[model samples]
Target: MKVFICERKMEVNYNIAEVYINKILFSHFWFHLLSLGLRMILSCLSSFRTLVNKSNPIASRNQSC
Candidate 1:
């Protein structure tokens, strides 16, 4: 009787722990995805800015004039 009760309790605890761990993993996955997305966007913007600067020498000269 005692062993059966103990086994059931352990199973319940295991289930609760699994839920908590899954929630943590889910949040971490989202955080990683968002950081990667932001990095991609910032890199794209920087590349665009450099391309515009390279192609707009007249704009730079006008500013200097």
Candidate 2:
């Protein structure tokens, strides 16, 4: 009877460990995805800024003129 109880406890511990590992993995994946999305947004904004600056002559011309 004692051995059976020990076995059950071990199984429960294993299951809990598995759940914890999965949660950690999922959180890491989500963080990486969020970082990648932020980088893409920043890159697009930078490109848009460059495009706007290039098209605006006043940006390049001397302000005194």
* lDDT, candidates in the order shown: 0.97, 0.94
Best by TM-score: 1
Question: Per-residue lDDT for 4 in model 2?
Answer: 100
lDDT per residue (tens digit) for residues 1-65 in model 1: 99999999999999999999999999999999999999999999999999998979978898999
Number of backbone-clashing residue pairs for each candidate, in the order shown: 0, 0
Instruction: Please name the candidate that would achieve the greatest lDDT relative to the true structure.
Output: 1
Model 2: runs farther than 4 Å from truth? Answer: 58-65
What's the lDDT of the predicted structure labeled candidate 1?
0.97
Judge candidate 2 at residue 11 and give its lDDT.
Answer: 100
Q: Which 10-residue window of candidate 1 scores lowest in summed lDDT?
A: 53-62
Clashing pairs in 2: none
Candidate 2 lDDT by residue in tens digits, 8-63: 99999999999999999999999999999999999999999999888777755766
Q: Name the lDDT value of residue 16 in candidate 2.
A: 100
